[model samples]
Target chain A: MAMLFSDPFESLFNLQKALDAFHASGWLEPGPSAGGTYPPLNVFRKDDDAVVIIELPGVKKTDVDIQAKGSTIRISGTRTIEFPQKAGIHRRERIAGRFDRAITIPFEVNVEEVKAEYRDGILALFLPRAEQDKPRSIKLP
Target chain B: MVAPQELAVQPKKELTPKEEKTVPARYYVPNTDIHETDEALTLVMEMPGVEKKNIDVKLENDVLRIEGRIDFSKYEGLDPVYAEYNVGHFSRTFALSNKIDQDRIQADLQDGILTLTLPKAKQALPRQIPIN
Candidate 1:
């Protein structure tokens, strides 16, 4: 099965394929992160596993919650912006509120093997494909 | 039900390259919030994926420049499939007035947000009037 897929840009190909499918289905609406998703994410594939990187500046680890089930993962967190007493805001651009996002991947993930790390206000999730989702080899008689 | 759009993450803005730099790399402008109090002005900037060691805050000739270089090594060996935002260094500049106490400026980094405190000079502070 691995021999059949030799393209080094498999990840990009998959992305294009996903976009094509969305276009064909008339679901070519803007991407979830275009303006509706909090804490934009970047998905990457490495071997049979995948990693999701999220940018959540000013969010503490204690405020974030992650859950994985089958092919979908949920991330929920709250961001609080505090100002000094009697502060007069001149310019406000940074946002603060509760955020929750659920994302689905192509392959089922092994919940036991899923790991997450938050560093410098960025969250990285390592998800391994489930054993049953792996391609099985067959020999022709 | 769809959540309010304002609560979602705003699109990250890419810095427009005005001139050629020594290093050819894309840069981003971090979102910033400015607030003022009786004593000082505070600026909060969001620069995710940047560490304290990789950040530079300089004040030269009444211009304050802030830059944070992202650690690209953290992304090595990973092939991007779907990218909602690009990974790049952060750069933003602000002009300061003489009313600001340049020597008393303080900076602190916490949870990827840089907080800069610029104390006002003695003459710049608001003073109460006295009636004889």
Candidate 2:
């Protein structure tokens, strides 16, 4: 089971610092200037596979694009909002626009075995480790 | 109208032992958008990983509350190497005013996005009266 930590604000602060570093290093292209920040993601390793989950609410499955090469994966999508012409805007907090994010895994992955599933606005990816990258245990003499 | 002195006051309900002992769980506030039209108000919220069965919405005493629980127990026993987004509960509250018709409010959830429509009360709607 996933455990909820007591200090989310601190975690978010650290994430912001990491994002800033990524931007300064040119590792990730700055997100769209008009909309909000990039979507939050979780990456974890399950044995010999790397699992990635991204939150993309209000985005259609058809609009999302995923690509993987070597040890890196890229995700790009757009979210659109449509309201009636006569509707009056009250409060607008959710941002809608195009966003792109690329993440690098710690180990080389098998591109052919990559699997992706989108459900409930979450995009989950399973990337299997390359044959040569899997951990091997040696017997002691 | 009955006089205030003649009305009987109801006793306040007591909290059960289980309710008193229960600790409140921490909740993450989901991103939301609010729009208003001539006839109604619309609210859209983002709550990923929440399904229909795990979502709860309650309206009482002019306060609207929404809660969503995401269960990740299915992945138990799997090793975790890196984690960024934490899986947990999502919750938010909204106070409704007299201008809204509480009984006619409607809500729908799709693709992890929740949309709520609060219709304006008849008396609160704008009207154009013709000059006699």
Interface RMSD of each: 6.8, 15.6
Which portions of model 2 miss their true places by more than 4 Å? A1-37, B1-25
lDDT of 1 by residue, B1-132 (tens): 344233576877878755756554567899999999989989999999899999998888778899998777565566666666666789998887647888899988888899999998899998999998
Superposition error at A65 for model 1 (Å) = 1.1
Error of 1 at A58 (Å): 1.2
Docking band of candidate 1: acceptable
Question: How well is each residue in A39-133 modelled by candidate 2, as lDDT tens digits?
Answer: 66656557678777777878889989998988778787777767778887777766666776767776788999999999888888999999998
Per-candidate alpha-carbon RMSD to the true structure: 6.3, 13.5
| Per-residue lDDT over A1-141 for candidate 1, one digit per residue giving the tens place of the 0 to 100 score | 011123433433333343223332321224333334776777777888889889999999999999888777888878888888899998899988888787777788999999999988899999999999998879899
TM-score of 2: 0.75
Worst 10-residue lDDT window for candidate 2 chain B reads B6-15
Best candidate, lDDT: 1
Error of 2 at B128 (Å): 2.6
